[model samples]
Target: MTEPTDLTPSGRLPVTIEEEMRSSYLAYAMSVIVSRALPDVRDGLKPVHRRILYAMRESGFTADKPYRKSARAVGDVMGKYHPHGDSSIYDAMVRMAQHWSMRVKLIDGQGNFGSVDGDSPAAMRYTEARLAKASSFLLDDIERDTVDFQPNYDESENEPKVLPAVFPNLLVNGAAGIAVGMATNIPTHNPGEVIDATLAMIANPAIELDELMQIIPGPDFPTGGIIMGRSGIRRAYETGRGSIPVRARAEIEEIRKDRQAIIITEIPYQVNKATLQEKIADLVRSKEIEGISDIRDESDRSGMRVVIELKRDATPDVVLNQLYRFTQLQTSFSANMLALDDGKPRTMGLKDILEAFLRFREEVILRRARFDLNKARDRGHLLVGLVLAVANIDEVIALIRAAPDAATARESLMAREWDASEVVPLLELIHDEGNVIIDGKVRLTEAQARGILELRLQRLTGLEREKIQGELGEVAQKIGELLAIIESRPRRMEVMREELLAARAEVATPRVTEISDALGDQTDESLIEPGQMVVTITRDGFIKRTPLEVFRSQNRG
Candidate 1:
């Protein structure tokens, strides 16, 4: 054949390149936005992060348990849930364990996990990890059908769609990511403050932003530093985007006679100490900044201390100001509160995130109550069957003896009806539907008959019989409590509040970052000495500054 006929469906219809490219690019962008880059508002986790936590929990690597090699957990996540590269999975897991990386670490690591100086972490095979106790709040009630589950990539296993987070994890531990055309850079907040804000919202659904801010002041970076002003924080909370200026904590100290030095204890969030030192050194070498006699890092286990000794005549304040102006001693954090909400990327304010978490937590509480109710009802049904068998012990024994086998005896038990007068009240209390009552008699269900057959001879003793009745009464009470939680909204809310308080007790800590009202503007004028200078402009328009003495007065210059 000269040419093969087109076998494609739609008769190989012709399409413009522009149309195809537009559709394909849009598909790819959505995939990245939903599947990878942004965190889910409910759990504050991307796919890789969620997978790592879930996998580690499944492997029994909890905080109380012994730590296992990180590579093992990474392998489990990649093979079962995430289906990604091992390096990416390990990197995500390591970040969760790093104290400086997460506001509240989700994982407790035993080995070295990098440093604030931007050093790389040790290999995953050498490091060990386990789930932190705080994670229990996120993972509790997961097995009770509180959240939905979807099949993994290869359809070989199932994983949760989102964790049944008790607290508002989205704001408590924040998140950062970059997608196709968007990115999120939400700063973390103190756990105690976040929980308080959530509780306040619950108490007053119509609470305004002003009232909420009173509870949660501003972002609390793990690397504690002073926030210069409140205006940026207000803008971010109101509109989900703003920049806050942060300055390192430094003090002028006299280390010798007639000489002073600058002592830096803390740096801006996400700023590397080593790089900052290098930048300062380069500026001094190029003579851009003057008066520094020596620079040394005296940081140790106690805390961070970068010492900048000054010349005898150098003004400590002036040199420190120059460092702030030319180095990373001062920086601004640009907050972009972007995350995935209901499978779409959204820019959410503080109120939007808290509201979403509340809605999700309510659903979790309802689902868990239903699950417990069903379980209690089932146990009560079995106990009722056991009681009947004990009441008619003589007849039951005779019938079993006459039967040829266990199967025939079970069928005979199912076929016969017994007096319902003794158990009718218990059945009503527990809401059990395993048996049917007609007039004054009821027949045993298949499940009940099998349970009776499996009963031991010792259960017929007087004390044992009394024990069974007592256990049945406890189960009945439990069933009624679960029913109330399911039927009434207020009862469920009370239960949720109690659980939240319990979680708060475990993870709450005092605020680390300090918020101040001092204004910080970008300028070098204040760092200059209080003296006159000569400004010269060339014919070509370049300008330069020189000391007044450099152009000494002459006869007629």
Candidate 2:
């Protein structure tokens, strides 16, 4: 601590270069670890992602557990892995596991998080939960040295930066996160297919993004919505990013056990579960949902039970139109996935991402060649062949060194050609290849022999070397593409954009002027002039806007 006289008014202490560097670096590291890398119990946000999946396997939150309040589950997460506030924890727990809540729900919530809308939970004591099947699968290999774990803030807890998340959690469960200059928004996938794709990747890390599609297919949203087109998924993965189009499952359901009506099984992936409900409530209050007899959150522990019970004999198509007309259920997800390149974050399209990954993989291959024991052994064996030829150099020189009467060394070796025994005449009586190499005065060691062979091989500059590099590069690209795809966000609501656009365009058609060639009538888009429009909005709910044409109309009317 410097004295007040030596320090400025800001209580500054002279920091050395080392201290400055160390402090600055540590601060950055902590920022990544605490805020970005680690998951918060409140929002279920890890530095890597905000979305999470929970299991309702056995100890799962059941409607039966004496109706344990939702608060209990939230409390457990807060006290354990996450130390955020209870409200945050509860919210995360509910959102992740709620069936009727998320369009592409991650968690398999067994108990209740409250209403499908933004309603608060009954109480902390009402809900309960356990590890989910998918969650357990994701965590299975955690202790196998397949993944890394770090200490918590107080060193009292440990968290896996990644779950060994074998199933491409980013894609399977979908994730959303905001880091310093980056964000991730990956969509959820079908559990079974995700597992298959993961297994495929592990079996041959060299698989292409296109190949992965065969295994995982497109996003298998929990809400069962439609992924209009999957062609962009490959490009997105290849480029480290791309958008997907998602849409709701609009099905005609029976009303009052008689008339047919449309029932929305899934909403847009981007719309918040809480926000969607509020919009629904507002519509009901506004009497815009005239045909809706009741909108009850029938979704219980078993499955999604969003019951939009309708009035008798209402047209289901019209109801669906109304839903699209006013709600968050129809939306768009803009994908801008970014991944690590050269140890730094970089935004990329699907193809670019794949290319970067491939390059990274090639580097790995080169590194392995220099490090892996088995590879080194194979390389050393090749050098043994070269040393055999070099040891007999003396005989060749003798033929050239002497007159024409001298014997030809080529004939001697040629006689033994195509057979290992041919070298026996030149090799003394050594059973081992190395013994002969030493006896012939080559003075070769295993490591040195391997090194020389490697240099020679690298100098080949031929098709074989290219083939090897190509294999390595391909693998690297595949892995990166997989990770990026998983780490990337999915576009769930994009499919309905054209529909929404057409609707909006119709609403904004600005009554175009047309010469009804016969009548030659003129038309205006709006009843009131842009500047002459006068609005009188009332707190009691009445809204009045003065029309511009009224001023020009005859006073007699």
Candidate 3:
């Protein structure tokens, strides 16, 4: 009683601190990797995102449904599946609804989610949300058992481990996250382009990366901008990591007499426009960048237009170059295409990601077909029982009339043998082995016996009996089709392709960011045209430029 244990329970073995710490740290790292940071390669969503979508779908917050209070969704997700803070869950949900964040937004938000100026979204109480139309692609087959499910953190509820994403969501929307010792920063691509590339891969698995690149040239940011050079795009797509430079789209325009301005229409992806403007102003005040007379934001609902007004004598091209060089007007999107593949984090290239998605989709298709086939067989089995009872109407009715209770009637039905000729072809069609023919007679199973005892009086009519045969024929045909789909690899691939094409048609949009062959860094001298100018100055200290052709040779004069 006086002896003290070393912080270990009595009768428990002692463990080294180092070993315990190492094991604990490893567990933490894996939790972060699987539960928080990385998106599943199948659905392109992290655990939190998957939970939110599943919860919303469960609550009937579908694309066609009316919007519900965002707080309700956040509460349900946190209480049921995600066990995280309400703020973090709401933030993730808000990002999904942001048009500028996700290439194909998954949520239809009814309030100010956020702005490209790095504004924080309003509180969950103020916002309303529902699933977007495109989100159906990921959750369509979830109820059909196309994907597996696991218990929630508390084991009180079930949630999908991964979505049965029919679309190539990983590439279409992309993802970014930071885990314990690793991170991921996948860039979004065009939906149409991604679908075309996937179809190409299906058609020819041996197609080279170069060919795939032809279909999907590079990342397409939701905010339109220019992606300079293909070198970085190639590196990222080939090696799963690279730095791609993006520049704002601007044009030099003469605003008024002798005044020029640079009108910026688009900014780089993830860049805060307000912060970018502040940085530019900081540089201007510090004299780091010169020649700016004024700066103003003239952006509106039509489009983005940040006007950088230049002094009368200021060179617009030079000032624009300085802005690009020093401010967020130009930025680099460093892509680290890391994600979870089969619960292990891996850096996947373009082809690797596509191949993994195709494999997963094939499995989903097969599982769904099997689930349908089983359902059809069960229905066909019941219909066979009814057809048998209908064939032997007199004997069945007489046995039921004599029994003292329903249980006895069921036993009597199972005890008696019936003609197997009528249901033999139907059984063969459904491939049902539950019913066996012995000496040209079949004994009813407990399920079939129950079915006969529960039959309604009206179902004994001639019309109802014919209806059973017709319905069984339909079920048998469906069973045959499902079996064919499961057995044929080519047909499964075709199904996947058609589903992907349909999703593409719904979500595909014109590429916003332009990819140019020019390099990121450009000098003002390169933009200047080769021409001669005559400089003139008046005695009053006014200066002007006159074209060389303005003055003719005046030797005689």
Largest lDDT belongs to which candidate?
3
Candidate 3 TM-score to native: 0.92
The lDDT per prediction is 0.89, 0.46, 0.91
Of candidate 3, the 10-residue stretch with the lowest lDDT total is 547-556
C-alpha-based local distance difference test score of model 3 = 0.91
Sort the candidates on TM-score, descending order: 1, 3, 2
- Per-residue accuracy of model 1 over 388-451 as CA lDDT, tens digit each: 9999988888888999999999989988899998789879978897778999899888878888
Which has the higher TM-score value, candidate number 2 or candidate number 3?
A: 3
Ranking by lDDT: 3, 1, 2
Pairs that collide, model 3: none
Residues 1-557, candidate 2: write the lDDT tens digits.
96447665698877789999988987896576455543322122353222122222222443333434445555545554565566666666666566543323434454545554456655556665543334443444344443345765567766655443322344444556656545666555554554454445434657776787676555555555555455545555556466655555566676545755455656665555556666777887898776766666555556454556666756555666566556655444555554444334555543343344333323332333333323433343333334443444454344434535323333333232222343343222212243233232344344433343234434344564455444434444443343333333221112112222332332221111111112111133321123576566889999886665664473447
Q: What TM-score does structure 1 among the candidates reach?
A: 0.93
Separate clash counts for every candidate: 0, 46, 0
Say which prediction, candidate 1 or candidate 3, comes out ahead on TM-score.
1
